[model samples]
Target chain A: MDLKVEHEMHKRRFSRNAGLGFVLVGLVVLVFGITIVKVRMIGNVPEAYNAAAGLPTAEAGE
Target chain B: MSDMSADKSITSGFENEAGFSDYYALLKPRVMSLVVFTAFVGLMVAPVPVHPFLAFVSILFIALGGGASGALNMWYDHDIDAKMKRTMNRPIPAGKVTKEEAFGLGCALSGISCILLALTANIFAGLFLAFTIFFYVVIYTMWLKRLTPQNIVIGGAAGAFPPMIGWAVATGGVSIESVLMFMITFMWTPPHFWSLALFTKTDYADADVPMLTVTHGREATRKHIFAYTLPLAVVTLGIAATSIGGWSYLIVSIILNALFIRGGWQILRRDDAAAEADDYKAERSYFKLSLLYLFLHFSALLLEAALKSFGWGGF
Candidate 1:
């Protein structure tokens, strides 16, 4: 009698849908983390490029 | 849920069929890359410098906004894609992705990108992102794409909005410099896409889409190509006189414009028999060159910015 092991039989398995879901989950998590940071307003005030008159400065624009 | 899986063609094949790459295609990565680069340049040459981490996050959301536009465009244009030979192999037409899945993906990403942008950047940048997405989907894709030969003309405004959105990321307001960049892309769109129309007019004709070439014939389209490129050159030279331009920028602009004009002339001189015999090679070459043309112009502008940073006479 000859028999194949269950682990051997499943060695090459791959599921595209699951892989896609995993990738999407990772992306969503990344985006979510960035959103939290931005929402909390945790960063330095950006510096203006020019010191000219008659235009909206960075802070004023914000 | 059972009904969704049962209809397989219209629903997400989340258990098996839809692969990672299929989802990626829905984002239109090629278009997204252009959005990212242009947005990055907009931020880089802006009148303010964002915090480094904030800058990265801002561009990431901008890219997501661009991807959302692509997904929504693909969702709406699936039928048009099915009819056109050039687009027939896209995810939806090829059965690799479903319309409902694409639609949901687009809506989700659009909200995520915009909300996060507002939270991270300023409300102006976030609102700009939201408006760009709305314009591309509602105004451009749903309304203009199939209604008129002038569709791409008006629709091009959606594409031109990215740099302005990017500029807002840093400065939180519009400027003449940002508007000039937007104009550069806006004016370039018709001729760039029309060059494509000259050779692939049959594709638009077959799909019942009113591209300029399909509506006006090749002669009229050829004339439009030269007409548009001339003004594009003028707009490009005008931008060179701005603070962002430099000696190197001027040199690149002149050479590119000369070649562009010659390319347009080549298309104008082609007869039906000649175009058919040569497989529209000249027109196709012009189309390919037009792609490089915008990229090089933007890259030259960035180079000017870098040189100016080093006190090399950009202003």
Candidate 2:
């Protein structure tokens, strides 16, 4: 009975480690994604976006 | 007594063998990358600008739809996949995952991606994606894959739909640019698969998939490749003439198609006995180059779109 309980505990610990690994990878991807989005939104569109959309040449809104 | 333990050993072996990675492999990430890149170009080239986050979300769902198609394809094709030496090691055929699990995953992802795309992008984008998934899984995999030698030719629409869906996400409608993008991919698929079939017909034959090479012979398949590349060259030029293209794109298209046609001609002109003896070098090189051809065309389009957006190139 004691051996069986230790084996079960070991399985639980392995699963916990796997769960942590997944979360770590997800966090890294999320960070990278946020960085890319920020870089793309640097207000450099200016009036170029407006002229293209035919929205009366002005700064791109949003 | 031994039978139960033997069964447990088999079951436990598979249980440990299948993991998160095996499930991800079922998504066919290489195929998904092509879908994502083409769809990204479509979205980028559209006249309307989608917010970065929204663009990301739209592409995420599109890739998910593609993955759903792949899982369903694996589920349905597992039998033939097991027979084909090239595909015998896929998730299902390798016994890492069950067909029922793949089916469930596909169905779930299909529903989630379709509904989430509708919520995130326009209804038209969502509908097109849903249709793409259904066409790949049912029209291509279920009915046509086993039935026709021209399966890739007709069913190529499934891959071609991604750019159209991406365009719809931005503009909520199709235009000459999006349709031309679709046409480029559509016309390119036959030669692509046929080139592969030239080298791998044995796999198709063993699986009874009736590929062009299996049905018509390698010589005829080579002739078909040469024929298809002719119009494919013209279609590439046709895309360059659209509003989304410019001189740079036109130049790239011309050069790429010239090399492509030259490659096709070499494959068509290769001495069959020599190829048989030497392991089909011409066919293999042509197959590898064909992979680069579509990507270069789309990349050139992306360059044009970038230039035009920055108030410089085009016309």
Candidate 3:
């Protein structure tokens, strides 16, 4: 009976730790996903860069 | 007998006081989601490639910054939140957490996030993060929120800076792409928020928030939404046409813009009486759709970048 009670307590502790672990993992994944999205969309392209740099464009605003 | 039972229930509510989960509820998860999405989009689109570990740190700090802003906003707006039905059950208003605790948490998190960003990333990114926290907490929450109908319009800049910050984290400098991304969010804010304001005008009125709908009427708000959305569609298409975006993105942009414009037009065409009659379901649907629209648009950009990196497409 003593051994069985100890085993149950260990299992409960393991389960609680596992739940906390999952929360930490979820938060990390959420942050990583956000980072990946932001990294994919920075800087001007060749066409727009040229237009902005005034590369003899006839377009009045350009 | 009924009065005694009601009194007992009320007393039991205090006896069984809510806990941490209730306090967490005040962070406004929906607004946080947009902050997360735009900030992520900024980090992804930058020219610089950050190491996986540092990337993780930067994004974590950004999320903390966003949460800190939300906490500070809640702390300051507790009184107004108490009066609004939508916000009545928030941590401060619901008496789950004291305003002082919220303020302290917000300040601590803000400082920690900014310092962490500076340590892990570049100074420019750190400065941007610090500014974003200051702008949201001071300029928006403390000043603009109750003072002007253009609260969202001007205050939206705070929310718009995250992508640029992300870009700076990667590149260690600002560029046109970051500015464009900033513009996209800046323009989208008014229309997205005004739609909610249209549906919840009474809540703003009760809180004395000078939202466009409350100050200028629903018709004017709708017109402004349409006006902003038209230019927004143009900008979205323009960004897609640029080198960073490819064919896949252009296709997605066209489709998304069409849907966005349609939603904006529907909002504009509906009269106030018609909108109010159906509990502003049309306006609410448009608002929800706008959220997904931005997510899908940015995801498409990510997809394009991935495809290009694999040498699957031409620039």
Candidate 4:
């Protein structure tokens, strides 16, 4: 049985994989960008994060 | 051999060979474009401005949500889709994507979009996106689509929510302007669809879907198309009086609404014989106009909002 490795189905499978890779990368970029914007908007450590880190809350520090 | 032939290969028997574009087609990209446009208009027209990046993200998620709903619609309606010539070549009906794949994709995208939109915008906007999906998938697709002649009338609500959801993304709640935007699309759907039905005479009938033309006689559908234009005119024109309204919007609405009403009247006056003789020319023209009608109205609103930014817009 001579099985072909470079069939048209292989091309479609590669395209689908490539598309999924691009989509995942795009999602990561979007999420990172959103996080940066959120952090910039706050301009300080969020109270929950501060509390979680065992640091003074924003109000307490103020 | 070509992929078409390769799809029948012995080794491919166990593996699904659907492509990326097939999955994308499940999203109904054409419909997503309308959702994106309307949602962007809604976001821009809100009194509260959104950050440009946030605005982009919100609109993208809204489009995704809309697309997700389209996928679910396709999944549920693949049977009828197979029957309709317009939809016979859809991913599922064409045998590219299975109905289960479409359903899974729809569910996953719906959840992702709603959650991301909420995290990007606000909870209300996120919740609104989820509700819009539920309305489209469950209410419109599963329940109303096959059961009622008024399917699109009520199902139209699902399509209309994008702009409102966009407004919510900015304002974090519904307002008169957003409701007005919703009404414009809502009232416009019947006439738009019925006109297409007038021309495509057999699609709905053959599919056993209860479209207006299928349930009601041609004359009744014609009359309904004209009647809807009246309210559609009122809503499109009425929005001009609100804060989003301006000279640009006002003038555009008046001209467009007048032409729309005239088009409806033309549709109403024509008989089946006249339409057939002319290859349904009037009906076809009316359908084309209906497409522009919603788009131009929203564009005018966006223009009004843009002018307001420069301190020159609104009443």
What's model 3's TM-score?
0.77
What is the number of backbone collisions in each predicted candidate, taken in the order shown? 1, 0, 16, 0
Encode model 1's per-residue lDDT on A1-36: one tens digit a residue. 233333211331344556756867967776687666
TM-score of each: 0.82, 0.82, 0.77, 0.92
Tens digit of lDDT per residue, candidate 2, span A1-60? 122233333554566568659956964674576456646765557466667668865334
Shift in Å, residue B216, candidate 4: 1.1
Q: Which pairs of residues clash in candidate 1, taking residues 3 or more apart in a chain or in different chains?
A: A38-B119
Of the candidates shown, which would achieve the greatest lDDT relative to the real structure?
A: 4
TM-score of chain B of each: 0.91, 0.93, 0.89, 0.94
What does candidate 4's lDDT look like per residue over B1-315, in tens digits?
875566456556635569889899999999999899999999998999888999999999999999999899999999999998889999899888989999999999999999999999999999999999998888888888889999979877888999999999999999898999999989988888888878874677788888777678899999999999998888888899898898899998999998899999998898999989999988998899888888889999998888888888887
Which pairs of residues collide in model 2? none
* Model 3 ranges off by over 4 Å: A1-62, B1-18, B276-281
Residue-level lDDT of model 4, residues A1-62, one tens digit each, is: 44466777778888999999999999999999999998888765677788889889967888
lDDT of each: 0.83, 0.84, 0.79, 0.89
Which 10-residue span in candidate 4 chain B carries the lowest summed lDDT?
B7-16
Candidate 2 docking quality: incorrect, acceptable, medium or high: incorrect
Error of 3 at B239 (Å): 1.1
Over all chains combined, what TM-score does candidate 1 have? 0.82
Candidate 1 structure quality by residue, lDDT tens digits, B1-315: 554344554433333355566777888898888889888888888858787777887898999999999999999999989998878888899887889989999999999899888877789999999999999999989988889898988878888888898889999999888999998889889988887766664577777888887788778988988888898899888888887777888898999999999999988887778989999888898888888888998899888877777878575
Name the candidate, 1 or 4, with the larger lDDT value.
4
